[model samples]
Target: MLKKRNFPAVDLIALEREACRRSLATFAQRAWHVLEPATPLRWGWALSAMCDHLQAVSRGEITRLLMNVPPGTMKSLLTGVIFPAWEWGPAGKPEKRFLSTAHMQTLAIRDNLKCRRLIQLEWFQSRWPVQLQDDNNAKLRFENTATGFREAMAFTSMTGARGDRVLLDDPLSAADGNSDAALLAAELAFLETLPTRINNDHSAIIVVMQRLHERDTSGLILSKGLPYTHLCLPMRFEPDRRCETNIGFRDPRIKDGELLFPERFPEAQVAELERTLGSYATAGQLQQRPVPRGGGLFKREWFGTIPALPVGCRFVRGWDLAATEDAEAAATAGVLMAQAPDGRFIVADVARAQLGPMGVERLMRATAEQDRAAHGAVRGSFPQDPGQAGKAQAQHLLRHVLTGFDYHFSPESGDKETRALPLAAQAEAGNVFLLEGPWNAQFLDEIALFPMGKWKDQVDAASRAFTELTTKRQASSSSGTLRGFF
Candidate 1:
């Protein structure tokens, strides 16, 4: 016979290679071993989600794809390295051209090298005939024997090049995300330049990144209602924010606050990450949102609501006034708060209005009268500006409007962020309580948006009230502290 050819063994080998070639996830698992045999693979649902979407792109099902996943999720390893190699070899699409760019050219080159190394492996070569051309095996650009090529470039260097598949991996660094010019440049490259670089109508573009800012490339695309299959996987599952993309793909997890990729990042690891990244970075990089999931500085869960004020509570009605009644102008706000016997802070009532100075004066006088009737012996706290006009305004209000009230005027010492610290600390420690009122929603909403909110009048008043309640008494000096100045 012809040397007794082992056809059964040959057929089994072909089947194994064909399975890897058909599924990106399967190929990745095998490729992971080839690339890093020391560390075992910890498979998760997120990997499956990404592979399914990428496979769709290869099959011409999704033309534009955007994936916003948490950092350290192996997004780069999967999309940048293995997907392209799998496509060229097992998928038998070696003629497909690829243009890959990142925030830095070095990162693009890093993945490009990984992909190049992957295709040349004996295991990969034993199954697929995809071989790199001897003429062009450089770092920035490389070509396969079948005429397909992978070109690595920086987001800033995307000039006169075209590709059938364009991939942008973290186009804006966290530091650069804060710069307007950097954001605009990255966005323009994605929106204006990259679209034109696609070789034909069948070309697909994929963007993978962790969100860094509200105006990041992903945010811009979503805001503009672009035709993209967006897959957002945050570190924790938020039931209300569960994403449903255009391709009828919905987040499968039903429970709120469920961990994503718990196999890789367990509960303890996530807690460590949250502690290490701080609130802001944890929110943006891990939670896939620019703002904290709880709140910026204040968490909504911190303030427990009480049916009524506790006994022996000393009260202060803090005011943050506006100069005009314009609809766009900040609303004049007054917050009445009390320091309880147990040293906790309790917010009682809020009076907010958009009015002129005279109207504000009337409202203030009426509110003071209401405070006197409801709560016994409540003191007033008003903010004084720096210049003579601010002093004059304070004197006018004290003499004419808030006559006979025990009040003091104090100029704000530092920035809004600094002033809000005392209240934020109390809120975080669960020492802040909200007395049941109709204004609870507005107060909590404004507090949650603190420093970042467009209108901070409510927060300013609340911070002042908390400060007034917590300030300690010092011995009187010659400078005469502005305490109860008649």
Candidate 2:
């Protein structure tokens, strides 16, 4: 038997690399390794799913894909830079042309250059022998020997360009996204201009961005109910909610508050981000909701503070119960209000917490105790949402949670916004006084955003409290007059 000459270690390594370069996922890992060898790869399920989606797009299985991920999550590197190169190499679509755009020209060019640098690496060129064509070897625009080309342009300057693949990387910048007009322009360009630039019917369009506004490009595209595969990767993994991808990779996080990529952005870093961005800004940029800043409804300065509750003031505690105990679930909110002698409402305290059904019952009982201690003869109001389920929930709470408390359960009359108008007007007119407490800032923040804020439990609870108090007072006044006449 001819003894097989033992292959050298270098030869075996080269053979393994060549095998890996055949698949898009393996090729992307190799590319990242070769280009960024010093940096450790903090690979996560989101990144893996993103790579699989890109491969699907390359194989013509998916025509359009929308990837919404938080900033600094390597979205740009994977989609805008490496995916195109992988297509030209492992996917064997060397003639594929790419048109990439960003909100700013400089960002687009920077990614284009990084792709160029990645292609120029000795290991890359050695594994996949793609050489840049000298004739069109500019930074913003470049071509390869196989007639493939990539052009980077600003979103505003995407006119008169054609490509087989269109990659939009953060087409709305943080500053530009804040402006309604800019967001509209971006949406229009995406809907009207960009689609016309596709080279053929089979061309692919990939959008990778953080949601900036409810009317941003991602929002506009999704609102149309188009058949586009979406991959949403919020920084914090929401256990109760799983993102479904086209490749059948559902989010695997089974616990609430789990970091998407713990190795890179740990819980501490995410908490710091929340503190820095506040609830409104963080909702959109980090949480992928993009609530407008200083949401146009309620202003902070409109609220005034009171030192103490007046004697013999009528009190009501309104409760809004959420359905689940998941951390991402809406909070169970209780707004405690006291109607003063002047007939203006004073928000004495606000309590908001996430709880399950059993937990909610316990919370309601505890709050009822606190209300009885603070203000004797307190009344309670709980919303009956709609349908049999709502009726059943209201009955359950009445029988179990508020058995001995003086409480009323009524079906919600109108939408949250319509009911909240009275309370909002009171605050705006300086008729509402918030008692000084630690919950004051949180209450103001939630009310200031109103329906736009991520959590509207407090606002809903306050509305119920105010409405129930005024209605009961009117009934009491009318009943007393009839008794006097008798």
- Residues 432-476, candidate 1: write the lDDT tens digits: 899999999989987875654446798889888888788863334
Off by over 4 Å in 2: 1-6, 9-14, 17-22, 292-486
The alpha-carbon deviation from the true structure for residue 298 of candidate 1, after best TM-score superposition, in angstroms, is 3.5
Per-residue lDDT value at 32 in model 2: 77
Clashing pairs in 2: 284-290
- Over all chains combined, what TM-score does candidate 2 have? 0.62
Q: What overall lDDT, based on C-alpha atoms, would model 2 receive against the true structure?
A: 0.80
The sequence of per-residue lDDT tens digits that candidate 2 reaches over residues 278-320 is 7655766776765544453567777889888887688888878
Candidate 1 local distance difference test against the native: 0.86
